[model samples]
Structure formats: structure tokens, C-alpha cells
Target: MTSQSGLTRRLSDADEIVPDSEYVSESELRHGSDQVVRETSRSLHDNDTDAIMQMFTEKEFETSDLLEICGPFLLSDTAYNVMYMSPGIINMIPDTSGAASLPVTSLFHPDDRPILTETLSAQTHDGSIMARLKLKDCSYAWSNITIRQGNKNIHRALYISNTDELYRSYITQKKSIATLEQKAADLTRQLEAVNKELEAFSYSVSHDMRAPIRIINGYAHILETDYCADMGEECRRLFDIILTNTGQMNQMIEAVLGLSRISQKELFITDTDMPALVKAVTDEQLSAVDNSDKINIETGNIISTRCDSVLIKCVWKHLISNALKFTAQEATPHITIGSERKGDKVVYYIKDNGIGFDMQYAEKLFGIFQRLHKRTAYPGQGAGLATVKRIVMKHGGNIWAEAGTGMGATFYFSLPVTDQ
Candidate 1:
């Protein structure tokens, strides 16, 4: 049981005494009783007086005793039995400590000491010491303290509590939050870097790749037209193959150039006839190949919705050409262009009975220079599909493919009729 300081009355024997108003308690009367008079009589009751005087005179207890003058009084070792005062008297007398006198200054919280002392001296039973104490090994502690009173010989005690564990836990949680935030920032930076690289690579595909392709294509055109008389037929065929390769290179370069251009174009948005546009692009692509007699067009009425005609026409051109190229061996290649209305948006599908792709390599298909088929088998620079993807994305549309190895391919694209 923790003891607190308090005050109470004590009964005593009547005496031939100075009939003053009141006398000290039995505990306090240990110094002198009313019957035991002393008038500079040093030799009289020398032992008991010295003991009581020693308690007051000792330098160790002096300042502590001064503080206890306004503290609560309690029995030495019990929290149950206590003594104190009324509100008015308590208001008059300011209390300073919560427990009995045993050096509490060492236990004082560094930040609380000054405020505690000044506020304690200012008011009685008002304010409390609620502070974190500095402990060993740089830890913290918490305590709630209040003032109490003892006998005329005032003494005080201080209460303490430790909070090192809770403080450590709080610090750990804050560090976790900071670590997560830092990781998020790192990921954001990494994403920005990846986007920049993609943009730079797209620019290279447009500018760097086309310069050499133009030289080869222009020279090949001159050779096939003007130098046909000088070369053997077999040699001419080889030159024609070279011309074909250069033309394919030109196609790939244009695809990437158009992709890069879509990013910079002013979004001149207006309602467009999607069905008519698809038909027109399909006819133009097939006429270039001169293979429509071999490849069959599926339907006259597919779907017409709002879109950028030039951009959408480019999209149709690439999709249709890819279908024609891959299905060249088919005796009757079938290509169907259609659109499905999903909720408020329209999704376009170009279904082709062609040499389709495997689903496993779906993620890599849109990457520039990533080719699923060998050059001997497919004969492309591998950028046409990537261009189609970029253009759709720039228009706030999503494009995807569904195909299985040896099965036909189906391309789907979704777009909102409204522009942002």
C-alpha cells in the first residue's frame, strides 16, 4: 500500500500548560508537550528535543520539508488511513507532492519540473504532473502525480510510470508508414522513366529507322525501273526481292511514324461513320495487295460509330493488311469487320481466318521490334500491330487480340463515342 501525506487532530492529556488555542499532534508533540517547558534550558529534555530538532535542522530534509507544508498527511505505510483539509483551507494552502518525503527531484520529468513547481505553488489541489520521464538507455516513462500533506513536519513522495514499450511501438509504426511512402515514390519514378524510354524509342522508330529505309527504297525503285535491261532475269528477280524487302521496311517505318504522329496530332474530334470507314480502308488495303479476289469480305453492315476518320482509317489499314499478309496461302481467306455496342461504348472486331498467334505471347505482341513469327514466314518489320495499339490507346480506346496457335485471330477494340 502506498502512503500519502495528510493532517488530522490528536487527543492529549490536560496540563498546567500555556492554554493556547491548540497544540501539535502526538506525532508532532514528540518534540515538546505543553507540560514540558523550555526557556533556553538546553540541558532539560535534551535527547528528545535534539532528535526532533535534528529532523528540522538536517540540510537534507530542509527544502523537502518546505514543500510538504502544503502536502496531504497519511500514516507511514498505508493508502487507506489518510488526513487532509476542507476546500477553502486547501485553496489557501498549496500542496506540492503526492507521496512522502524521499528525494523526488531525481524522479522529476525534465520538462515537467518547472511548470509543475510554479503551478503547484499557484493553486491548491489544482493541476497535476503528467509527463514523460527520461529513463536509462534513452527510454521514456509516464506518471500521474498529485500533492498530499503530512504532519507539521511536512514531507512529500513522487509516483512514477514507464512508457518505453509503447513509445517504441509508435516509432516502429511511423517508420513503416514512411517506408511504404518511399516505396510508392520510387515506383512512381520508375514508371515515369519507363514511359520516357518508350517515347524515345518510338521517336527513334520514326526518325532513325526511316532515313536508311528511304535510301534503300529509293535506290531499289531506280534499279528496278532503269537497270532492268542491264541485269539477267534471275538477277532482276533478286533485285525485285530486295525491292520487296525495302518496301516492307518502308511500311514498318510508316507504321511507327504514324503511331508517333498520333501523340502530337490535334484531336480534331467529330462524329464519323465507322462502318463506311472500315469498308474504305479495307478496300484500299486489299487493292494495294491486289488479293481481294483471294480474300473474302464478310458483311456490308457491321457497325458505324463516332471516331477520327484518318486515325481510324489507319487502324483499319493495318489490321486489314496484317490479315491479308498472314492469310496469303489460303485459297479463300475470310476477313470480317464488325462492331459491338457494349453498354454506352462501341467495340470493333476484325475477325480473320489467318495464321493466328499464340495467347501466351500476348503481352509482348505490342512491343516494337517484337515479332512472334520468323521473317521468312511472316515477312514484316514487326511494328504494324504496335502502331495499331498505340493509336487506339491515344484515342482513349483499348485494343486486344484473341488467338490460339493454328486457329484464326480476332482483334477487338473499344472506344467511347464522346471525347475528353
Candidate 2:
């Protein structure tokens, strides 16, 4: 009932036409048809085109003229039977002659057929969906299909645009990210194995060295006790030096064994009352030494945290003992122990007015057997701070110090806040 000119005007007035740059040439479409059958075999006659136009007129919809200017598109009934297909869409079909009877689902990729079937069965289909459509060459291209419903849902028009290039690029990037993640995991495992082997080697060497050191110390003690009175003063003094050097060596070996044990120990994490722990360490240190009256120790508010009790206790013992030993020379010795909130972590510090070393040597303070002062002056194997650093790091924390020559020192450590 609709005139040919009227249908052309209606389609030209429609707003969703594909740009001219996107339109497929008739020659290109014929090239695809040549691989199957001649283009004339699939072409519609003048009256045939008029009858398809009349079908749209009865439904009060006009869309056939759009087939010339739009991108690959198709019209289908609720039953998914192809009513009309554009030349560009015909180029995508391997056999255009059989297109009219072909089910629309056959054009979609196998993995995407279920999605198209679901949309056709929906009460209404008016939005857009993305799907992979099968091409004439048997390959698939990503497409954006915009669905437009006609009056009374007699038919639906699908405007499809190709996005194959972009989809392939995204797939390539995803595979690259997965490969990088796998490489990182492999490197982490290798590092862990190397660290375990080093820890075992150190433990074995320390364990074996203890016996020889013990023998030397025992023999030297015996010679001093039985032969000191008969020997000259210089000989006795030299013998005393041997005993002293052997004692220091034994202590260093013990420190190494202790360090290895801490590395291998399993953590027993718990909610610890930090204030009580600090108080207990301070009390025990003061009780063991007779200088409690000379030293002024102050403790401020320390928040609770979750940590391993035994390991953390060792940390407190080392830090507190170091503070006491360094501040012993001060006429008015003072020590402060407290903690404060720093963002999402709690920073605890021990301040002492002691004989601090230069700030330039701070990096060496936590290395085993590394000392800034003479052994006779400090009377330590320089393992206390190293042990403290290991314990703090095991708890997922960090330790650092600030000091100047002859000035006071402050050691701070941070622990994440696990409780409100």
C-alpha cells in the first residue's frame, strides 16, 4: 500500500544511518557473491522489492532503503527468520542465495548463539548487545548490534558494527599481563630457596665452631691456674690476653647461633599488652643491676598490638639492655619508652641520653659484628641491635635510629595497628 517514493523518503529521514565511509561498495559485495553463486541469482526484482516494501507499510515501518547506506544490518521476525539483509551483511554470508530461509542465530558465533536466543525470547528487545558474528571466511569479528523494534513487535532491525581490531588488541594485552605475573612468581620462589640455604649453612658453621672454642678456653684456664706463679709478668699478661680473645670469640659464636635460631623459629602471634610487656622488661633489667637508683626511667602511653610474644619479648630485652648499658656513664641517666599512632601504624621509640655515635655510622649499627666503638669500651660483640632489627622485620615492621657524636640516641620501630 506504501508508494516506492514515500518509503525512500521515510528511510532518508531516519536518524540512525551509518556514515558513507562505513558503507560497503557493490563491487566488494559482488566479489564475495562470486565465491558462492552469481550476484544475479541473489538479486531481487523490481516487483519483489515492492512487495518487501508493502510488508513494512502494513506494519507502519519503513527500513528497506536504509540497507543501501547503513553498515551490515538485518531484519528478523520474533521466530528469528531473516526477513531482509543488507548487501554488506550478504557479503558476510558464505551463501547469500539461501539467506532468506537461514536462521539469524546461524550467523552468530557458536559461543554467542545462546545470548542472541535469550534476547529474541525476551518480552521486549530495544537495547544494544555485543556479539561475535561469523564472517564469510569462517572467522569471527566482534560486533555491536543495536536492536530497534517495530510496531506491535512485528519485526526487529539490527544495526551491527565491527570491532574485531579492538577486541584482538585487548586479548593480546591480557595474555602479556598473565605472562609477567607468572615470571614474578617464579623469581620469588627462587629467592626464598636461596635464603633458606644460607640460613642452614650459617647454623651449621656456628654449631661446629663452638666445640673448638670451648677446648681452647678450657686449656688456657688450666695453664693460667697452674703456671701463673712460675711465669714472668709479661708471659702472664700475654696468657691473659689469649684468654680474653678466646672469650670474645665464644660469645660471637653464641650470638650467631642465636641469630640462626630466631630466623628458623615459628611465630606465635597474639594480642599483646605492649605497655605491660615494656614494664616487665624494664623491671627485670633494673632488678638485675644495682644502678636503678641512679637512672631515671619514664614510660608513656603504649597501645596494644598483635605480635609474637616470645620474639617481641626478646626485642624489648635487647633494646632495654642496650639503653641501660649506654646510659650508665651519664651522671644523670634518663630513658624514655613510649609509642604513638602514625597513620595506620604505631611507632614505638626508646630514647636515651647516652654516649651516642655519629649519624653517618647508623647504617652499620644493625649488621652482625659491626661496631663503631672499640670492643674494650662497649664490651659487646655488636649483635644486640642486629638481633633487634631481625625481630622487628619478622613482625612486618621497620627499625631506625637517630643520633649524633656525644649526643643522645633514639631508636624507633613501627608496627601496623591490627586492633581499633
Candidate 3:
């Protein structure tokens, strides 16, 4: 039972062991010991030192030869107390004084000490464990730790290999993922605050501004009916102008209110007969205007779709009235309403041969208060398309338009088909 340190001291003088002997050179000794050393280490793991000692004796090698070939490792008792530290281990450590007698757990990071203790206590021979070790400079490095039963029943061997660079990359990636998740949460809160502010603004505009406009229109109407005869021609003309301007203002207020309400409205979806709905809206629009006779309306066999009937009706009313108003100058106006299946959705379109607009401003058409034509040419507050867009979006659908000046216009909307 030679102590590991005594054996290590003798191995330093190994060149003198087989010197000037019969035909055996130093290279031959080393080559023959390579295979024998590998077998000894394997047998050491299996606690079979009898075979290892027999092989060494048969090869005419001493215990110092075995110590020289065993390579770098640490020997510890079952209690994890360090018994021996190889010369390689001493060279790698920046501070090697008193390292051999220290607890083997002192080599690992404080947080990793418990994990190493549990793994060794389990005496698991199935596989190796891994942990971060404390380097001599107080920095940390990752290493794979293998525990094998030693030749002595009370002793064990620990084999450690550096794996620091790969573990550091893994830690960096995990930190980046955590940072990205925090940023995403912050953005979501900002978006929620902005939405709340918008709702409050819409409510204020709808309620606070309508009262004064209503009062002005009411006064103008009273003067027109009660004081018409008492006024001169000039006064009468001025009164008529005031009344007409007030009427336009009232239309503007109604349009703003409609746009605001669409944002707060809830949708109730059902199978709606679109052809009948379109016919009813068109008939109502035609009856209101005296030029219904000049307008030729054509409707296709539209498929029934699942949608909010009230909201969809509003969409049809705005589109139909827009066609009628723009085509007032034409001696004969043509308006077509139809629907077709496209992929998983039904695309419905309203096409009109009316005073169309340039396609370049198409993107702005659905914005609030956005209009291509002047108020004089088309009497509107420019909120019709904006309202239509909101309603379409609330139903998880989309709206778009195509037009060229005097070439008529077509407005298309898509709704997903419901599963049967």
C-alpha cells in the first residue's frame, strides 16, 4: 500500500528503474505500458486491483510506473476528503498550497457544492454529473465530474474536465430571452393605455359638442317660419343661408356620432339574407330621392353569410347612398351589388358607374374626415368610409376600394365563411 505522494516521488526517478537492462529501451517500456495503464484504469473503476497488480508484475513494471501512467486525477475518500492531487492538477491551480488535504467540495462553486455532494453520496456509477467549479482566481468554470469506486473500499476517484466556454454561451442565450420577454410586457402595457385614452376622447366629442349645434339650428328654423313675412328680400335670403349652413352642420355632427358609436358597438353574428338586405336598403335610398327612375340597379345571387346583420346593413346603406349621390349628374346611373366565394371567405362588392376618384389617395379613403371630393360636389362630412371600415374590422373582416377618375368605383369587403 504505497502512499500516492511516495509513489509520485518515486515516479520522478522512473528513468533509472529499467536502465541498461537487457534489450528493453525507454520507448518500448512506454509503448508497452500504454495498453496496460488503460486496462488498469478500467479495472480500478470496477474495483479489481488484483488484475491490475498482476498485469504490472508480469510486465516487470513497478508501482512508480503505474503512478506515472495513471494521468491527472484527484483521489478522495467516501466522505469527500481529498487524499491525493496529481502533478497536473497542481500545475493547473493558481494556488496549490494545502490543496491535497482540503475537502473536495471546496473546489466547486458554493452553489454547486451541494449538488456535487448529493451526486457523490448517491454513488451512481451509471453516468457522470456536471457542475461549476471555482478557479484559483475566484472565477468560475464548468466541468464534468465522474465518481468511481477506488481500489480501497473507503476511497473514491474524481475525474473532472473543463467545459466552461460552452456553458457560458448557454447562460448568455437564456439571459437574452428573459430580457426580450420583459420588453414585450412593457409594450403591451403602453398599448393598453393608449386605447383607454382614445375611448375617453370619443365619448367627449360625441356628447359635449352636439348641444350648441342643435340650439343654433333650432333658432334658425324658428326665425324662418315665424318672421318670414316681416323680413325684406335681402333678410329672407340671409335667413335661408343660415338655415342651410345649420343643416350641413347637423349632418356633420351625426356623422361624427356614428363613427364614435361604431367603436363601442358589440357584434351579434347570424346567418343573414344579404340579397334581401341589399334590396331593402337600395329601395329605401331610391324612394328618398326623386331620381330613382334614372338609376338602374342590378343585384346578383348573393350567398347567405354569418355576420352582424345591423352592422352589415349600415355598411350597405352608406355604400348605396354614396353611389346615388355621386351619380346625380349622370342621366342614367348603373349600380351593381354582388358576392363571390374566394378561398375561405366570401367577397362582397358594390360597383357604381359614378363620378369616381383617383386611385393614388385610396389609402386615405378609410381615414376619419378623409374625402377625395369637395363638400360642394358631394354633400358629406367624409366619415362614411371610416365608419364602414370600423364596422368591417369589428367583424374580423377587411374593406378596400378601387377607382379611377370618371371610370366609376368598386368597393370590396371580405367576410370569413362559417363552418357548416
Candidate 4:
């Protein structure tokens, strides 16, 4: 039997290995020892020492030769003792050695010892196992070990090959996933902070800013009510201009606040009937405006969709009211609303016969305070389209318009189809 120190020194030097059967080359390792053992055992019974002599003769081969031809492997008895180790195995298992004394388990990582032990302990003794095997440098390499039983003097043969590259790739993949998860968490925190700032801005616009405008408008109204009759024609005209401008400013301020609210509002999504929602908004707008009986309203198969009912209603109110306002000057104002299926989405459009702007400026139509017509000609702060655009985008939809001067404008929006 060899001592632990002796085994370590021998292993470090890359010495001989033990195999379960007669001398077999590296290429023959997978073939198992059944045929070799049977032939060698028969030869031994006939009093021949040729096989034994050949094993020692092959052992004289250089370690480099073994490394090139064979990977690290070991031969052990049924009790798992270190018997014969190849020159390749010797260079890998540097810490222990003994003739039928040291267990091959000593060369395995502590974490992998139980796995190998359980594999060998199984009823089917011949099986494959994966574990980290110790190297001469005291590190470990991932190795696949296959143990096959022998019927001769040797009990089992252990064939081991390194799979370190595959193991390292798995480790790298885990690290990359962790990094992505951390980045996602950071982005969520940043979004939350931005939303909080928006909330505060909305509050300021609703209260801090509107209060002074309200006071100015109130005083202007009082002056008109009490002093308009006493003023000269020029003075009265100037006062009227002041009152009108102040009122327009208030409307602009309200539009800005509405835009802010749209951004901050959380969506309450649900299945809503498109025709019902549109008709309701249209009725409300018509009842509030003049010539309710004059504007010709038309429709098509506007399909039902999933969306935030309140926000979607706001969208309809803006579009319908916009159509009615622009078409008010026409002798026969016509408004049409309809939808059509386009692939996986439902495209809804509102068109009106009115004094439309040129297509070249279409891109600016949805921007806040961007207006092609003078406020004197067509009154609005130009935030309605911007608000509508925002609401549509939040629903994961798109909005676009097409028109020419003196012709009608058609505003189209698409929503993802949920029913289908």
C-alpha cells in the first residue's frame, strides 16, 4: 500500500494508472474489459505471462504520449480504492496515492463527492457521472466520469474527461441574467421618480397658476358690468379686447392642465362598445352647440375594443367637437365616423367637411399650441389634438390626419384588436 504523500508525489509526476482488466489502450477504453479480461484470464490459466509483460512494456511510454492518446482515468477495486492510474490521471490527481489504500473520491471536489458516491452506490454499478475533478495545480475542472464493471481481478474502471468550457459558459449565462434583472429594477425606480415629479407639476398648474388668472378674469368682468356704459367708444372697445384676451388665456391654461392630467392618469382598461361611446359623446357635443339639426353625421361598423372608458370618451369628445367647430361655417357641414379592420388592429377615423389646413403642416397639428389658423378665425389653444394623441399612444395605438386647404380633414386612430 502507498502512503498519502507517496501517492501525491507519484500523481504529480504523472506515473502509472490502474485498470480493471488486462492492458487496454486509450481507444479501447469505451469498449469495456469483457473480451480483454476473458482472453487474458484464459491465457493466465494456461500459465502464460505474455499479457502481464505487455502491460509493463506499455507503462514505459512517456507521459506526453499518454496525454495525447488518453484523458485522465483511474482503475479501482469494488471498495473504491486507488489501484491503477494512467499517466494522464497521475498529472491530474496530485494529492494522494496508495496501492488499494487511497480512495479515488479524494480527487473529487467536496461538493461532488456525494454525487459520485451515490452514483457508485446505485444497484446498476456501471453508470456515468459528472463532477469536478481536482488538478495538480489544486484547482478543479468539470469532468464527465463513466464507471464500468469488470469480471476479472479489477472491479471497476473510471474514465474521466474535462468539460470545463461548457460549465464556464453556464456560469457566464447566469451572471448575464442577473445583470439584466438589476438594470430592469433600476429603470423601474427611475420611472417612479419621474411620475412623482409629474404629479407635483400637475398640482402646481391646477392651483398655483390658475388662481391668479381667475382673479384677473373676475376683475375684468366686474369692470365691464359696472363701467362699460360710462366709457367712451374707444375705451369700451379696448376694455372688450382686454376681457376677450383674458378669457382666451384662461382657456389655454385649462388646456395645459388637461394635457398634464392625461400624462399622469393611470388607465382603467375594459371592454367598451365603440359605437355607443361615440354616439354618447356626439350627442353631448351636439346638444351644447348651435345648429344641432344641420350637421350630417354618418358612421360605419366601428368595432368594440378594450380601453380606458373615461379616457377614450375624452378622446371622442375632443375629435367630435373639433369636427363640429371647423364645419360650423360650411353651408352643408358633414361629419363621418367609421372603422375598418386592418390586420390585427381596428382603425377608426373621424372626417369632417371644413376649412382644413394644408398637409405640409400636418405634423405640427398634434403639438401643444401649434395651430395653422389664427385664433381669430378658428378659436382653440391647439392642445386638443396633442391630448388625443397622448391618450391614443397610452392605449398602444397610433393617430394621423390628412387634409388640404378648403377640403375636409380625416383623423384616423388605430387600436389593437382584443376581441379577435
Candidate 5:
């Protein structure tokens, strides 16, 4: 048989194992009465105790020492009856004095009994299992258990490691995710309700508000045509002013309704030929205006983008119309449409050699009914840029303008590039 000092040296090496010669007979293995047997048992138990104590005291250990150090561990038979337990286990568990020879399930919470039973049942002597176990205070802790088979498949050593903090964090994160999901569902319901109210309001504005405006416009037309011959020049001029103001009011109301409709419209995104769309809008606008010959339009290489074609067409129309209207006084109106790639998006811009506004008011440029130029000079209700901004926003894009007084203006808009 191997000597006690030799066995102790082998255990100290941690990586080396004591040979079978070191083990005593079955009777001595159980009772450990022989001097050599007693010393070997004491060495094994002390080695584990020292490693575990070092772990708790110094908070560090080598990997080879880890199996012995990670404790609150147990030694059991194949039937999961507790044969022996580490000192740490006795200290960690309350009322465990008579725990020896009892089923391992006694140490677990009632809810966790099945977990230990299943792990013990499925595990071979060579394999191990992990589970969360309850403590004396009723709090749960995560543990990793490792098992080592002994001679005759009779005895096993189980190494346990605490992992309570990690499990607790995982549970907290799961609850947080559940809470966020509930909040998202609540927000979705609120959004749907708001959309319904907006739809109703839009319907009322389209029908109820426009009816009176149309009637006023019709009466003004009748007064100009049917009563013009009977009225003096000053009265005719007054009638003219009434008709003009009514027309402006009608445009403003239409612009507001258009903005509302665009917001409600569902986007049908597709690969749109931006150059062709711009050309079409400019052509249509040119056809409607009398000063089309005075305007010179230039277009650069424009890449195709995924967007709502109808809404984008509206955007281009408003921009082109604004350019033409602002530059109408110029001897030669110059307008350029072009685009370039910027990171994940394509930025398209319209440059106009026309009368431009101060950059200080740029923040208010896209606001509804906000005007930098007088209505008498510009001949618009200042809703064109606002409508363009809304359309751009609907397409997951943005629009802005750069300008200086009397120099020129460039309007830039960006659209994300997506596969067709």
C-alpha cells in the first residue's frame, strides 16, 4: 500500500492522482480505522477544506484546485443517498446534522425537488448536473454540480459552484423585457385611437369647411361677371380684391387638406425613376405657366430610389413650382435638379437662381402658413414648402433649404436606398 506521505504529496500536486495501491480494503475505506487509511482520508478532506477556505478567504484559485474549492458539495451513492458532505455544505445548509444517508432531495426546496431528482436520475457517475437550490433563509442560488465516479461504482464526489448573481441578472432582464413589451402594446392601442380621431377630423375639414369657401368663391365670381358693368372702377377694384382674398383663402384650405391627406395615405414604396418623375413634374408645371419660356431647367444624373411615386411626384411639383414662382422676375430663370449618394441615403437637391430669403428664417421655412415674402409679391399662401416637408417625412426622408437674400436657393432632400 502507498504510504500516507506519498498520498498526501500526490493530492497536493492537484493534477496527479493517488494510485489504487493507495486505497485500503473495503472495510478500511468505510471505517478508515487503519493509520494509513485515516491519514489518507484526512489528507483528502483537508485538501478540499483548504482549497475551499482559500477560495472564500482570498477569492482566487488555480483551475486544478477549482473542483475541490467550489463547495457546499456532497458525496453520494448511485441511489442519490447522501454518503458524506463537505464542511461548507454543513455550514451552508441549516439542520443538516442528520442529513447523511438521506435522499439528496431533502436539501432542495419543494419546488426544486424535482430538479435535483431528475438530475440525479439522468446523471451517470462520470457525468454531472446543475440546478438552483434553496438556502436556510429560503432564498435560491444557482449551482453547478460535477460528479466523479469511484471504485465499484459505489461512491461519487459532487463539486458545486455558486452562480446566483448571474441567474438573478437573467431573471431581472427577462422581467424588464416583459414590461417593455406591455408598454409597446399600450402605445400601439393609443396610436390607433389617435389615427381614428385624425381621420374623422380630416373628413369634417374636407366636407364641412370647403362647402362655405366654395359658395363664397362662386358668389364673388358672380359679382365680378354679372355686376361688373353696373359698378364704378373703384367698386370693381374692391370686387377684384374680394375675389383675390377668397382665392387665397381657398388655396390655403386646400393646402391644409392636402397635408392631412398625405399624412393618412398609406405608402406604396417601389423603385422610382427620379429623373423621369422630376421631368414630368417640371413639364406639367411649365405647361400651366405663361413664363415657361423664360425658365431654363437643367437636370443631372439622378439615381433611382425606393419611394412612394405619387407622393414624391407631389414633392417635386411643389418644389419646381416654388422655384419658378420665385424666379419669375429674373430676366432668365435658372433651375437645376440633381442628386448624389450620401452614406446610406441619396440626397436630391433643386438649385434656383432666383430671389431667396434670409437664412435666419430657415427654421420657419417649412412651417404651415409661414411666409418670408409678402403674399402680394410671392402669390402663395406659404403652404407649398410645408406640404413638401410632410411628403418627404412620410417617405422616411427629410427636406431643408439653404438660401441668402437676393442670391439664390437650394433645396435638399434625402431618401434611404433600399432594394427594389
Candidate 6:
């Protein structure tokens, strides 16, 4: 578009940006505050007074606006003048470097000064003169120095820049991060110790008690069969009762074993074929005396899991068996086993249409030897769920039950994604 004359210019290509060297001064330049950069740059050249004024020069120096944002500033007029000074300028003045200069050097620990001097000198030589210095008061600090070329410039003329506040804040932040990391590590160690203890305790209960129980059952059977006729009727009846006690004791012992092993044994993690394990557990239950026709098993998606196959199958058996046993009087017991992916975890659920417990008893359900029903009503030592609890805990997972009295029970367990 043209101005007053109504002449028009067509737009072609977009303008490109280049560094200062390529945009060299040509004819005449402007300090045209009224004009846009593109218009001004097109006219700028060496002859322009405004352009010379804008050029940075060695004689004048000032702290950069950037430096002000990072920290506080202390400036001598000399430092102010030399800020934009060309590199390699030394600013030291022997007298302004501060009193007791030689004496201050003497105060440095004999072993420390050489290392400090070498390091400070190296920094100066390499174009960076910021240094952390230890003061006479035992407080340490950081200071930035600009060395400008001058007749009076020497180490003695130097005055240090104070940065204790910024340094202190940096140190504090570093220390806080270190403290949190250490606390996290300590907590991890404590948790690991507690878990080890729980595992050991579970193992001891399972392996140690089962043997004595088996012995008691064995001897009771031998006495009943071998000494029946030789014994009086009263004695025979007592033996028979002992035999019954042994049988119940065996059931209790096995329950305890199941619970303990579930919690204690190290898991043999493998990629399990879920359909196969479910079928195996179901077949085992069918083999149990008088159970097949009484129960109907409902199956769903049997997802594969990286888990202890044997122990997991045992968990299934105990839950299913419990469902069947509790609903022994029901015309037909219905049991459902299924799985789903919940976020990064696999959730497996077992639901049973049986003598479900009151919801208030849920917390006590997984506790060893804790039972809601009487011994004769639902005969169990209440070890099965406890075993389930341990197994879940071992996998860095959790188990819980949802139920209402006589409405049926559902147990759900979760395994972490890592196990998948």
C-alpha cells in the first residue's frame, strides 16, 4: 500500500532474520523511536549518530539486567564501568583489595592456601572468577569478581561480592531433598523386616504343627482297629470317641496348614494357564466325597497370571470348598469364579451362594482360628481365609470379602501389574 499518492506495492516473500554481522551498517541509520524495527533496520548505516550511540563500547559498563534477577548486587563505580568492558580486562587495585591483604593470606590454613590459590588463579585464567571463599569467621561464601585492566588493579584492591543468602538457600534445598530420600529408604528397610517376620511366622505354623496332628490321627486309628475286641466296651467307646476327635483334629490341622502355607511359602511365580488350574481345582473338588451333585460351579474368563500356580489353585479350592460346605443343605450351591483387569492390576473374584457371613464379621474373616459359626454348624478352624490373606500379601496385593448373612459371599483378590 502507498501513502498519499495511492500507489500500491504487492507483498512477496516473508522477511528473514539474521545475526548482527550479516545486518551490517550500510548508508545512513536512524534513532527513529517513531518507526517500526523493520523500517528502521532498512535505513540504518555507519554514518548515523544514533546508531553509534546504540553500539556497546569498552569505556562504559553496567551490571546486566539478567544478573539482577539471579541474586542481590554490590557494585563499585569501577565495577559498574567495567561490566561491559572487553574480556581480559583486569580490575584489581592493590589498595582497594582491602586491608591486611598479606595478613589475610597468612590467616588461611597453611595446607589450604596453595590449593585455594591454584583454584582461584585457574578460574581467573579460564574467564570465570566466581569463587566460594571461607572467611575468618568460619562462614563460607560465594563471590563474583570482574578483573579489569588498570594501573592500580591488583589482588589488594579487590572487595568480595557477598552471596551468603543465595548460597544458604541452595544448601537448604539440597539438604531437604537428601533428608526425604533417606527417610524413604529407612521406611523401606523397616517394612521389609516386618514382612520377613510375617513370612517366617506363617512357615513355622504350617510345617511344625501338621506332623504332630498326623501322628495323633495315625495312632488313634491303630488303637481303634487293633485293640477293639481286647478292650472293654467302655474302653472301646472311648477309643471310638478318640478316633472321632482325631478326625476332627485332622480337619482342623489341615485347615491350619492351608492357611499357614498360603501366607508363608515362597511363591513359585510362573505364567499360569488359568483355564487349566480352574479345571484342576474343580476336578479335585468333584473327587471329594459326596460333593459333585450338591454344587454347581460357574466359570468365566480365566485370564493368565504370573503367579504361584499351586498356591493360587489352593486358594480357589479352599474358597469353593467353603462355599459348598456352608451351603450343604441348599438344594444346589452356586459358585462363580471370574477375573477382570482393574487399571494395571488383575482382580479375581469368587462368589458363592452359601451361608454368607454378616458384613460386620468381614474384618475377622481372614484371621486365623476366627469363626462366626459354631463348631457343629459350619465345622472349620477358620484357617482358609487366613491363608488367603497371606498369599495376597506376599504378592504385594490385598484380599477382602463382601457378604451379608445368608445372602451369599464374595471374595476378591488383586495382584499388581508387575505380576502380570
Highest lDDT scorer: 4
Report the lDDT tens digits of candidate 1 across residue range 210-302.
788789878887877887767888988898888788788778667666666676575666678777787788778878886678778885456
State each model's CA lDDT, in order.
0.62, 0.76, 0.75, 0.77, 0.76, 0.59
Task: Kindly list the per-residue Cα lDDT of model 5 for residues 1-420, writing each as its tens digit.
Answer: 223233333554543343345433445444543543344455455556574355436645354343333345678888878887765566556666754357877776677788778877777657756666666555556667667777878877776554334446656876898999999999999999999888888788778887887788798888778877678889888877887777777787788888888888899998888888988999999998898888899999788899999989988998999999889888999999999999888999999999998999999999999999987788778888888999888878899999999988999999888876
For model 3, residues 1-420, the per-residue Cα lDDT tens digits are: 113223333333332222222433446546654453344445555556576568777875776565554434688877888888765455444575845468888877889889778887887453578877665556666787767786656888876654334345645766788888888888889977876776777666666666777688788878778877678889988987887877777777777778767776678888899889999999999998888988999998687799999999999999999989888888899999999999888899999999889999999999978889987878778888899999998888899999999989999998888764
Q: Which stretches of candidate 5 lie over 4 Å from their true place?
A: 1-164, 214-243
Q: Residue 53 of model 2: what lDDT?
A: 56
Q: Could you tell which candidate, 3 or 5, scores higher by lDDT?
A: 5
Q: Which prediction has more favorable lDDT, 3 or 6?
A: 3
lDDT of 2 by residue, 1-420 (tens): 012222233333432222122333345435552332232222232224454456567753445444454556789887877888887677665675844487777888988989888876673858888888777667677888878888878888887765434346555766888888888888889878977887877867676777787788888888888867688889888988888888888888788878878887777899998989999999999987777899999999888899887888888898889888888889988999999999888899999999988999999999999998887777788999899899889888999999887798999998877653
Instruction: Please count the clashing residue pairs in each candidate, in the order shown.
Output: 19, 0, 0, 6, 0, 18
**Cα RMSD to native, each candidate?**
17.0, 9.9, 14.1, 11.9, 13.5, 18.6
Which is the winner by lDDT between candidate 2 and candidate 6? 2
User: For candidate 2, which ten residues in a row score worst on lDDT?
Assistant: 1-10
Q: Pick by TM-score: which candidate is best?
A: 2
Query: What are the runs in model 6 whose C-alpha is more than 4 Å off?
Result: 1-264, 289-291
- Which 10 successive residues of model 4 have the least lDDT summed? 1-10
Better of 2 and 3 by TM-score: 2
The deviation in Å at residue 306 for candidate 5 is 1.1
TM-score list, all predictions: 0.44, 0.66, 0.55, 0.63, 0.63, 0.51
